[model samples]
Structure formats: structure tokens, C-alpha cells
Target: MRTIVAQDVVSASKFNRFHLLVFLWCFYAIGFDGFDIAMYGVGLPWMMEEWNLSALQAGAVGSYSLFGMMVGALVLAPVADKFGRKNVIIICMFLFSAFTLAAGLSPNITMFTIMRFIAAIGMGGLMPNCISLMTEYSPKKQRALLVGAIYIGYALGGILASLIGMYLVPQTDWRVLYYIGAIPLLTIPFFIKQFPESLSYYLARQQVGKVVEILNKVKPDGNFSEKDDYQLHTALKDGKGFPVKKLFTNKRAFTTIAFWIAIFCTMMMAYGLNTWLPKIMQSSGFSLTSSLSFNIMLCVGQIAGTLIGGYLAGKIGYRKVLVSLYLMGVVTFIALSITTNVALVYFLIFLGGASTVGAMNLGNPYITEFYPREIRATGMGYAQAIGRIGSILAPTLIAMLLVTGIDPKMAFATFAVPSILAVLGYLLVQEKYGSFDKVVEENGMNEEFIEGENKRIIQS
Candidate 1:
């Protein structure tokens, strides 16, 4: 079989029509994940009103979803390697679509909570695999940009959910929003027909015939030669077994753990504010209408931040950009907590949303770049799973303080501490490690390092 060389990825302009089509599917899957996740925030106010829930009860809903996501990311990420990325993604989409629709059909709080939990699993699994698939298929130089760009779907979804919720809140029931969520299911069949499994996975698994088929599909005019056979084996063998264990086995152990911790801290700040910001503002004397409108600004900032982060990371480097953004976020979170001036609060809120969302968008691709294709999904998954833990705790902890009549600024301040942890984590990882390229070369995955230096990360 002819080998798809690393150089082929470097010259992205040569990507044939088939690659572009597959690329579209990858974007679509992530887009669906983005929409489903953001839907929770949009429905929060209406659901609380309809059920007469306490602030703690409302927070529980967010917790349940994060809990579900944690479980999903842990379970599905590794299993996707064993089974296949495409199949797992298809199943994950179905799980969330069906359960989210069930959320609409719930008669009481118990059912809605249960359904959201189920949907969270699907939501959690969908993200890492979507990221992995995109990375695995992309040209080396474009990996970070494409990965970050695809996440725009996430911010877009957040905006879409807010818009839909705002528009429908006046006329239709909140339950109907869940019904609209199920629309993602319609794309499942189309994905199944068009999606390609990761070439790296197939090569590693020694499915030579399938690898050749996929490569031919990826590069229709290119010829496969026997010399490519050795490279395929090298790529496939690069990252097999307990990926998390492997990450820790080398000098990378501490750095890897630090990155995960950074992700956790970053997500805690993001989700804490996302799930509770409106509630906190309302309690601080803002009207529900104004609080709801704030989401539009937040999402707009998120989109801008995501685009800017992607571009900046491509130019400056991911970790530096992420660290700087997190610091900015911490400052904004502080400003948001203390300010009562409506206009200024809105501006700070938007800036805060931009930093947090952009940081996440930039960070995921950075994590994905740390591993070879064989274990890339798993690494991203563990980071996301651990990150979900932060998300799970943020709303719960903030709610507990608020219920006890603690100061609202103090409650927000509690959530802001994680950003400091994240900054420390990034700095520690960067200071401790060499470029990831040396590690990958030392680990002997040299042949499979298809992407160039621009996309390569240090071991951390």
C-alpha cells in the first residue's frame, strides 16, 4: 500500500475533495455537541420558574449534567479507541438527542433531572472524540486552527440556544426547547454515511486494508507504495495501552497532570459563571429580563474570543495565550463580582465570557496535540472528564454559599479562585518541560509525526 506521508499533511492545499467532505462532518459533530451543551443554560430560568425550584435545586440540575458528562468522557474516550471513533460518536449523539427530547417530556423535576443526566453522558463523550477526529484528519499546520475554529460551533450554539430560548420563552413552553434539541438526531444518518474512521487508529490496529482504503479516499490521486507500510506500523504502535498511564510514565507525568489540573480550574470558572451568573445577577437586584439578555452578550464575546484565541495561539503558542487569557478572566471575574453598575457589569460579563470560552477552545487542541493519534482522544477525554468535575462542583458550591445568604460577591469570588490555580498549572507545566517534539521523537513515534513543528506541542 502507498503511504500517506507527513509531508502530505504539511501541504494542505493539496487536500482533495474527499478530505474537505470528511472535514465538514467533523465540524458538524462538534457543532451538535456545542448546541446540546449550551442548551442547558438557556432553559435554566424557565425550568426553575415552571418547577418552583430553589436556587440549590436549580444548581443541582447543572451538577447532574456535569456528573453525566464526567461519566461519559471517562467511559467513552478509551472505548472509542477499542471500538471506533465514528461509531462511538454516532452513539453519543443518539444518546443526547433522545434523552434531551425526554427532558422535554418530563412531568416533574425527577424526570427532567434524570434525562439531563443521561444527555450529559452523550454531551461529554461527543467533545473529545470530535476533537480527536478533527485532529487526526487535519493537515499538521492547520490542526490547532481547525480544532479551535470548529469549536466556534460551540459558541454559536450557545448563541443559538439563547436566541431560541429568548424568542420562544414569550410564546412556547420551555419543554418545547428540548424538543428542538432533538433535531441533532436528523444528522446522525448523514454522519454515518459520510464519516471516515481515523487513519492512525486503523494503521495502529494493523488494519492495513482499511488504512489504504481511507488514505485513497483522503488522497484519491496519490499512489500507495510498500515503503509506506513500515511508517503505518510505526504510527499505529506509537500510542497504545493505558494512555493515561503512558502520559505519566515518562518525565511528562507531572506536566501532564498539571495540564489536566489547569483544564479543571479553567472549566470550573467557566461553568460556575455560566450556570449561575444569571441567578447571581438576579439575586444582586437585576431583573430576569436583563439577566437573560446578558447571555447574548456572553455568547457574542465567546465567539469573538474563540476566533481570536485560535489566531493568537497559532501565532504566539497555546499555553502562553491560555495563561494570559486565564489571568484576564480572573480580573474580569473580580470586576463582575464587585460591580453593580448595569452597563459596566454587562461589559465585564462579556469580557469574562470571552476569556473563559476562548481559553477552553484554545486549551483542548493543545491537549490533543500532546499525544499521538493512538491516544490523543483518550488524553483529551481525561482532561475533559476532570474538567467536568470542576464544572460539577462550581454550581453546587456557589449555590450552597448563596443559600446561606453569603454575599454574592463572595460566592463569585469562591468560583474565581480556580482561575488562579489554572494560571499556576500552566506556568508550572511550561517551565518544567521541553518541546513535545523531543519527547515524541524519543518515544519513537517519529515516523507518525505527520504534522510539522508548528502544530507540535511539548510533553506537557
Candidate 2:
């Protein structure tokens, strides 16, 4: 009996129903993640009015959820590495949904803020694990596109939140939005039934039975047997030294630090804009309806940007693409500061969304490519957690500046500075570590295995 490496089986398989199923579920999970996060921003204007919140108070409320997400990303995400991706994701889905529902029922701002924080723990855990599972299941050639496609759900979620707010919030209470967030819980039963554990996780555990079972589904034609052994083509084996510690060893220290910096700056800008864009537009003389419309436009641009950015990164290189996006983002922010025309403001906001939110999401595939499977979740989780520092600060900082009587354009320009720093971070990474593809190739299995499998399938 011949031994088949798990990854080879996945890479060699044709795009089929199984891959589509995985994509759909991952997309569903991530879409809700975005919806839950964006709901606060969509409802913020109403909450401020109803509660009589000062800018600082509202900003602090926004930070509560982000801080919870930081805890979840840093603390809860690593558990997926030890337990299983499917289990952790299911738990997280339940955690966020239940608490978000509770948030709607809170009587006071303190209670509401507490619920949001608790719910965010689950929100934070879902993203990295979802990204990791998607990466594990995807073919190397299509990895970037798959990651990007799944995250389009995130943009869709944001759009949905904006739409709900626009239509429902005016006619009803803001709590209705939180009630809608609870809808994701209905999908939990289906997820329990359909979602598969990562094959790499199983293979890492040396669980031959589970590996063969999933591989059979992944490549239905393959007659995988119990006697057939499995391998991973990776240098580090499962249960190696502290997963987090490994990140700093083998010359990964600098790349790891650089990537963290990139995530931090990009996330600061992304979250800042996400939390405050509507308010900023409103302050700039746009009506509430027009401001929310800008939020929708921002998400529309993000959807387009993710697809386009992923395609461009595949062709030119991830580093070049990110650096260019960040530079373009800086220019767009400056344009936004000076523009008074409503139409121009909409255009600039769309571009800003593309450069900020879209660019930030593009980092997921790059991070997955950089780390080994053994610690991929940990590496990603830590990066996300550190980035949350910026997320945590974004809303509060913008609020403070605005409340202090600073020009809204200057406030936005302050946010733009992070994009320049992000560009520098990417350049430093390229200088130190080389291209994203090169790093992935160094860590990945031999190309011949992929080619040979394709040839064998064709011959069969």
C-alpha cells in the first residue's frame, strides 16, 4: 500500500462540490463575524441619541467589544490548535450569538457594553480559525483567491448591517439590530452537521482514520485504505515545542515582528474607519441617511477591492500589492479631507474602504502562507490580538479628537498616517524575508508531488 500525504491529496483534487461546500460554510461563518462587528457602528448614531452619550462615552463603548476580541484572538484562538478547528468555531459561534441577543435586552449602557465585550470574544476567535481552515483545505495555487472570496462575506455582512440600520432603525429601536445579529445561531445546527475538521489537524495528530475519511471526500475517486500511511511534508511535527515560541526561532523572528507591525497599523486604520465613518460623514454636513449610505458604499468598495487585490497579488506579489494599496489609501484619505462635494465624498469613501478594509483583509492569506500548519493559528491569533490594540484605540482616539474641536479632515488625516507606516512595514518585510510566494514555497511540499498527482488523475 502506498502512503499518500494529506496535503498532496487536497492539492491534486479538482475543484468540486466538496470544495464549494467548504467555501460556503466558511463564508457564512465569516459573514456573520462581520455583521456582528459592524452592527455597533450601524446603530451607534441611534445609541448616542437615545443614551445621550458624549463622543468619548460612545467611543469607549466601541472599544469594549474590540478589547474582548483581543482577548479571544490571543487566548481562545490558540485552543483550536490543540482541540480542533471545527469544535472551536462552533463554540465561538454560539458564544457570540447568545451574547449579542442578550445585548439587545440590556437596560443600561453599562450592561450593553458588557454584553458587546463578551460577544466579541467569540467574534475574535472565529476569524483566524476560519482563515486557517480555509487555507488548509485550499490548493496552493488558488489559496489567495479562496481566502479573498470567503472574506467577501465579511463585506456583505457589513452591507447587510447598513441596510438594516437604514430601513429598520428609523422605524424601530436600535435593539432590533442586535436581535437580527442573533440570527446566525440558526445556522449552528447546520454547521454542526456539515463542517469538517481540518485534514492537516488530523494528520498532525497521526489519526489515520480521520485523515483517510476526509481525503476520501476531498478526492472521491481515491481508494484510500487503512493500510495507507499519511505524511505532511513539513519540518516540524505535531505537538512540537510551544507553538508561540517557534514563531521566533529559525529566523522567523524578524518576519513575525514585521508582520505584527503591518497588522497593527492596518487594523488601526480599518477599525477606526469602520467604527466612525458614519459619524464623520454626518459631522461633515451629510444627513444621517446620506452618512449611512456612505457606509454601504464603503463596503461595496471593499468587496470589489478584495477580489481585485487578491488577483493583483497573485500576479505581481503580495508585498508590492499591499505597499501600493497603502500608498493609494493615504492619497484617498487626503482627498477625503478636502472634498466638499457629496458625490466626491462618496467616491473617496469608497476608495478609502478599498484601501483600508480591503487591504487589511488581504493580510490573512499572506499570514497563512508565512507560517507552518503546526502553529499557523497561533501566529495568526497573536498577530490579530496585537492588532486589536490599534482597534481598541481607534474609536476612542477619533472621538477624543473630534470632541476636542479638531477638524474632521485632520482627524481623518491622522488615521492616514498609519497607512504610510503600514507601507513601510511591508517594505521592510520584503527586504528582510523576500516575496510571499518564496516563503510559501520554502515551507510547502515539493512541486513534483502536485504535478505528479495532476498527471495521475488525468491518466485515470
- The most accurate candidate by TM-score is 2
lDDT of each: 0.74, 0.82
lDDT of 1 by residue, 277-382 (tens): 7677667777776666787688777777778888887777888888888888888877776777889877877787777877888888788777655677888899
Report residue 422 deviation for candidate 2 (angstroms). Answer: 0.7
Q: What TM-score, over all chains together, does every model reach? A: 0.89, 0.93
Report the C-alpha lDDT of model 2 over 1-460, residue by residue, as the tens digit. Answer: 5656666567656677778889999999899888988889989999998899998999999998999999999887678887788999998999899999999999999999999998999998999898888877876667778888898999999999999889988999999989988887888998999889977677766777988888788878778867875654442365456778877876788888888898999889888888998898888877888888999999988887888998887788677888888999989988888777878888888888888878877887787667767677888888899899989999999998898887776677886799998988777763333213221222233333422112221111
Clashing pairs in 1: 1-224, 2-224, 2-225, 204-236, 435-458, 436-458, 436-459
Model 1 accuracy (lDDT, Cα)? 0.74
- Output the lDDT of residue 146, model 2: 84
- Looking at candidate 2, what is the lDDT of residue 448? 35
